[model samples]
Structure formats: C-alpha cells, structure tokens
Target: MALKATVLKARLNISDMDRGYYQEHAFSLAQHPSETPNRIMVRLLAFMLNASETLTFSKGLSDEGEPELAERDLTGDITLWVAFGQPDEKWLRKASAQAKAVRLYTYGGRTVPLWLAQNKAALARLPELEIWEFSEEDLDALTGWFERSMTFQCSITEGVLYLNNDDESLTITPIRIKDRS
Candidate 1:
C-alpha cells in the first residue's frame, strides 16, 4: 500500500509592510512521504510571501507539471506560479509561457550559488521570472517552528521576513537573484 500524505493545519497572521497587505489565513498542507520538514516549511514560507485569496497549493512533489503554489483567476487562468528549489531552464521557460508571472525560491548552502551561476543567463532571458534565494541557516531555522497544528505571525518589512510562534522566531531575508521587470 502507498503511504498517504500527512495533513498539517496552520494559522498564519501576515503583515506585509512592503506590499501594504495584512490578513490571516488558515491552511491545510499535505506533506508528501518523500518530502523533508525543511522543504515543507519553505513551501509555507513561499505561500506567505505571495499570499492571496486566489493562491492555492498545487500537487507539489507529486506533480511535476504544476508549481508548488499557484494563483489563478476565476476563469482558471494561471496568474502567478511559484516554485521552490533549483529548476532547469526548460521548466522556467515553460512556466513563464504559461503564467502571467513566475517566482522561484531556491535554497541550499553552497549548491545554490553554483546553480545560479550555471542558469543565470537563461533565467535572465525569461521576461516573467523572478528568483529568490533563502540562506541555508535561515531555512533550517524556520524548520524548527513546524508542528502538526500551529499558529504563526509572519511580518515582512522592506523585504525582511519574520516568522514568530509563541516560543520562537525566525528571520529571513530572501536574496533576489534575478528580476525580469
């Protein structure tokens, strides 16, 4: 029998000063058997960063054709596509063509720099792409706050992010590697 995805519930109170947005969102995330806690947390973080009523988590890790998170219009057009980790140029090209905007959140210590160097030129050519990298230390720190049922207050100001639970807090500043308008 196949292992089922674990369902985790969370409540996020977000205050994004940079975008002048404030809202509280409840999420039910399904963690795949093969996924690590760190990756799961990163996906949550990505969702927080681009939180919108229309944004929804896709069949991540299980579906290669869909993004980790996507924002769609009422007409079912993909407005925004959000991906995590290192994706190849072909995937970037395909996502850019399909969505109105695409954002990639990459994390991993030394490997990220090398990956960026290799794909920078091709990624730069995509007019609808934006790339952000989270530092390994920060990513690891965020993982510590995960729980099956949890609550968090996420604040973003001037591109700096802070995720706070009652017991602990983690700050992350995602580096913008590429922005094509």
Candidate 2:
C-alpha cells in the first residue's frame, strides 16, 4: 500500500514588471506525501517566477528523470529545467545537458553554505545553470500563507517578489549564487 499525492488547486495572478509580462494562470499541482509545506510553496514560487504558457509542473519527487518543473516549446523541446532543494551534482549535470537553461533554488538554512562550498566549483562550469537560494526565514513566512485552495496576487519588481493573499503579504528576494550570464 502506498500513500497518494495530494492535489492542490491554485489560481495565480502574475505581474512581472521587470519582464513586462502580465498573466493569470490557474492550475492544480500534486504534493507528494513526504514533501513539506516549504517545498510546496517553493514549487509554486518557481512557477510564478517563470510563468509561461508552456511552463508546467512535472512529476517531481516521483519521476527521477524529469525536472521539478519545465518549460517546453511547441515542438516539445525543453527550454528550461527548474529544480528545488539541493540535488546531486550529477543530476544537475544531466539537466544542464538536456535543457537550454537550468535553474536551481536551494534552501535549508545553514546547510546551504556547506553544500555550496562543496559543489560551487563544479556547478560554476555549467554555462546554463543559475542558482538561487531562499533563506529559511523567508521560506517559513511564505509557507505560512499556503492553503489547499489558494488564489494569490503576485508581483515581481526589481528582482523581488511580492505575494499577497488579501489578508497577508510576503516579500521575498531570492539571493542569486550563480547567474546564467
């Protein structure tokens, strides 16, 4: 017997002033049994950060070969591969080889420094890889706003994200460890 994934419904209103992109997307995402609320929110944030018609949540945690999220072209060519948490270097290497761009969102507080010290040199060599880190406190605040049926108004400006659920708002600025440029 196995535990089933929980399906979460979300409607996101996005205004990316930096990119001059504005769109609203409504979708359902699955949360694995072992995944925490922080991870779920991270996934949603990743989708909001790279909102596109072709960007979609993949079989994350369940499918090892697939990215946590991906954006593909009409021809089914992968344009971007997005990963959350700290993945093995080999996994990132494979993702870098397969996708046009690879982005990793690393979280988990103090462990991040040690992890970066061990892997930064190897990761820096990957031209397509961009790494961002979410602070534990900020992530905790973001997770505090999570709900099963959620409708969020999200705005991004000057590389900062403002997410509001009407009752509360969270400001998040992910720190970039490595830029694709």
Candidate 3:
C-alpha cells in the first residue's frame, strides 16, 4: 500500500530572512562575488513594488485529494484571505477581514469602521490606487525615464539603485508568490 502526506510551513519572517529568496536572486545577477549593501536594498525595493496587489483566493475540497489554490469571485469587491502558506477556512476569514482593515488607511482615509468593512467579498474589489504629487520637473523626468526604459526593451543597469534619504528606507516589501503549477 502507498500513502501520501501534506507539507506546511510558516511565512518567511521579513526582518530575519533578509537573505532568503530575493537577496539570493539579486546576488546571482551580480557579475562579481562581493555582495553590496546597495544591491540588497535595490532588489528588495523592486520586488516589493512589483508584487503588491489584490489576490482572489480559494481552497480545494478535502475529497478532491491534495489542497489547491483557486480564484475567488472577482466580479464584486470583497475581503480576501491571503496566507503565507496553505490556510484553513477559519484563518482565511480572519485574514480577509484584517487585510481589508489595513488597506482602508492606504487609501488616505480615516480608519474603516468594523461594520462597514466586514464584508470580505465586497472589499476584495477595491482598486489599489497610489497617488503621488509630482512636480513639473518630476513629471518630465518620469516621462523621459519611461520612454527610454520601460516602453522599449532594455536591460537594467547594474548598481543603479541608491538611497536618497533615511526616511524613505522604512517601507514594506510586498509578498511574492512563486508559481508551483
């Protein structure tokens, strides 16, 4: 007879696991062996900016064999459960509520009332809007940068990321989900 087992793990601790995935990837991209502090910061920032988003999540049925990830409803805005690893339904419901609560402040508003933000499905459809007040010089620079870099296909320059101030350093690096399927 044959048997199967399931595997579970906690989410990587962001503060402690600095060298785990993102840093390793960035180091591999380097031509030399010495790991620069700036490279670590650059890759981390890039990873965060790219990965933040609203994800619809669903779980597989127990009788279906191994659990699986599936899409939830995207038609309506709702709160969603996002886990660092495979999650149980109770945890999902709790996490969905928490995530929605946190995002309310991100929209530049007062704290969302518990009653108003309780619907998980309704909160999921909220668009992630990032507003930046750009000056005329900043606007022109952004356009020029996008035209020369993002619009056309070009390899990114090495060691180009740098820190401008101490205040800009405290930022949350968004979670990146690796494709297993």
Clashing pairs in 2: none
lDDT of each: 0.88, 0.90, 0.25
C-alpha RMSD (angstroms) for model 2: 1.0
Q: How many clashing residue pairs appear in each of the predictions shown?
A: 0, 0, 12
Worst 10 residues of 1 by lDDT: 59-68
Q: Over the stretch 1-181, how does candidate 2's per-residue lDDT look in tens digits?
A: 9999999999999999988889999988898899999999888888889998889887547787898799998898789999989889999999999999999998999999999999978888899999999999999998888888999999999989999997998899999989995
Candidate order by lDDT, highest to lowest? 2, 1, 3
Provide TM-scores for the models: 0.94, 0.96, 0.19
lDDT of 3 by residue, 1-181 (tens): 4232222111211212232223111112221124233322322233222222332223322323211221233564343222222223344444444333211111111222332245434434333311111122322322333211111111122312222221232222222212111
Error of 2 at 13 (Å): 0.3
Q: Report the error of model 2 at residue 155, Å.
A: 0.7
Stretches of candidate 2 off by over 4 Å are: none
